[model samples]
Target: MSLKYIDLFAGAGGLSEGFIRAGFEPIAHVEMNGDACDTLKTRTAFHYLNEKNQIEEYYNYLKGKITRNELWAKIPDNLINAVINTEISAETLPTIFEKIDSVLGKDKVDLVIGGPPCQAYSVAGRARDPKGMTEDPRNHLYKYYVEFLKRYKPKMFVFENVPGILSANNGGYLELIFEAVKEAGYELDKKVLNAKHFDVLQDRKRVIIIGWKKNLKLKYPHFEENEPQYEILKDLFSDLPKIKNGQGEWGAVDYAKETNNYLEKSGIRNGVCFTSQHIARPNNPNDLEIYKIAVNKWVQDNKRLNYAELPERLIKHNNTKSFTNRFQVVNHKGISHTVVAHICADGHYYIHPDIKQNRSITVREAARIQSFPDDYFFEKSRTTAFKQIGNAVPVLMAEGIANKIKEMIK
Candidate 1:
């Protein structure tokens, strides 16, 4: 039988996707956001259909030929019920337990994986709050995660978080978390892992803590870094059609060029000729000019344009002392910066490298940067999609971790 695992705080199943690709069976996915839940359900349906050789039903849904409800009808009820969509909290603990138990049956959870919302432990969150978000309710979520470890007693667990977590509350919070995990009868190891080292196109660093039952004698798996051999633009983006601001569709659109080795090998383009969510956001004239200037400076001079240095007329914000380097054009010659949830607010920080496009990277572009496959459908509006993509683990990075874990377990 396949190893079974539960994904707590699963955000659109990025980490879970990697595990699934490594042949683990997902017994349950617990999350809070309704839209993210819908996305989880959609992905669950896709996997079920794929297993049964009925992937055509999934393609039909992507092609706008069938409704999501119609597609779910093709999957087993147990498979669909496995996605538990409520928040993980003291108030919802019992109810969440009941939901997870319903699907668990006689199966033993082999692994538990997830990261709590990292906003409380992020540097940006600290800058915004007077107390550095130390008192934020999210800061205490590790207690709930410990509770899951106590309940499941899985052979192993993977805890992911931002690097700032080590410094949160002057590091007391992280210490307490480690104590809790140890007290639960497990030995743990943590390392700061970079997504780029795992073959992800962007540079994303996170705190990865792996814990195993004391009797298992497993230590942290050695993750070998596999750097990209191709340029970010040539391998990751050159094939997508160049649409102007506010141009392109949210659904399936034609690929600008044929698939390349990286696209196929990483499964980013996978069996699809046409891709979805390749649309660009509409930008105003002032922002457009600023975007062009930023792109030109980056592409031509290889220097970032300072927002405070823009022509006086184009400067809108009064506080010019900080955030001057806000507008960043994605570099064509290299990988992108970390894709963050902030992209949902504005594209100023994520301007496209293509001078002609002259806009922030689109929904699909952001997803590709995160290493999601072309056929991975994100439910809801483009803004919500960006949030999900930004908040997710790069599919490739997650898969690398999962593959190593599988080897360790075997």
Candidate 2:
């Protein structure tokens, strides 16, 4: 028997993907974004394709060698229905519950996993709109999460979010969350975890809260006491084929055929030829020159650049001194800075180290930095792809937590 779980606020299924890779059976996933839901459906379908030896056909479709209809013709019909995409809301909760009940029947869920939208509790968001954030309905989204826990009473639950959550609403929000979970008869343990401390190549930090049913008497998970061998950018992406700024898409018929240790170690399945989402955006001439200057300064200034020191021509705006560390040339020798949704706006905060590249990092590079497997595809437009990747918890980080949960259960 396999452990069964449900995911809520499941953006592009990143957390769910990690659990799946850890050998759990995902019972259902709920997200409100249509584009992200589409991504979830296709990725779920791909898993089925893997099981049925139909991945080759899908790859052929990606290669543009076959019509969409031809690709569908060869895939199993059931594989197409592998995971149902439920766009959730207040009114739709009952219907979603009914579907979950019908699917699982009498089998109890082993775990419940998700993080409610965190913008209301993020430090950057609070800084941007301190007044508006206080009244934001998103601040209380955790209530819905608690409601699900009350209904299902899973053996364990994993909640993920930004560390800012600790002090959100001057500590009121965190208190409310703990009070609700305690009332529901669960013991909670949480900590702020850095991705670079767990084999990921980015300096991303997030708070993971784990709850076990009070009767279980399970030991809470502790951070790995030993120092982690943090991966630099090269460890994660040096094997990928290089691309110039504004480079058009380039994927071969059988991509992933030649992969590096990062891909293989990350468990990315082979046979992929061309990279997905590797296309770069055209850089503005001024920004292009700034990238060159930034990378050079980054290397010369001991891997750091001060925005105030740049020449006026390279400075995009006046009075920019306050935005110290505004233009960062990511150190290739060190772990990357955190990837965030702001990357969707522009890569100014995350420029490539190589001046020759002369542009912000591409979606694929961002995904790799987040520890997503090379073969893992981000769907919809490039903007949407960037947003999903930016907002995702690193797959490796999530997997490490899930594996610990699995051990506690056993």
Candidate with maximal lDDT: 1
Q: Against the hidden true structure, what lDDT does model 2 obtain?
A: 0.77
Number of backbone clashes in candidate 1: 0
Clashing pairs in 2: 251-274, 254-273, 255-272, 255-273, 255-274, 256-272, 256-273
Q: Deviation in angstroms for 391 in model 2?
A: 0.4
lDDT (0 to 1) per candidate = 0.89, 0.77
User: What does the lDDT read for residue 114 in candidate 1?
Assistant: 95
How many angstroms is residue 32 displaced in model 2 relative to the true structure, after the best TM-score fit?
Answer: 0.8
Best by TM-score: 1
TM-score of 1: 0.98
Model 2 worst lDDT run, 10 consecutive residues:
248-257
Q: Per-residue lDDT for 93-132 in model 2, tens only?
A: 7987887787677888899999988899998889889494
- The residue-level lDDT of candidate 1 at 367 comes to 90
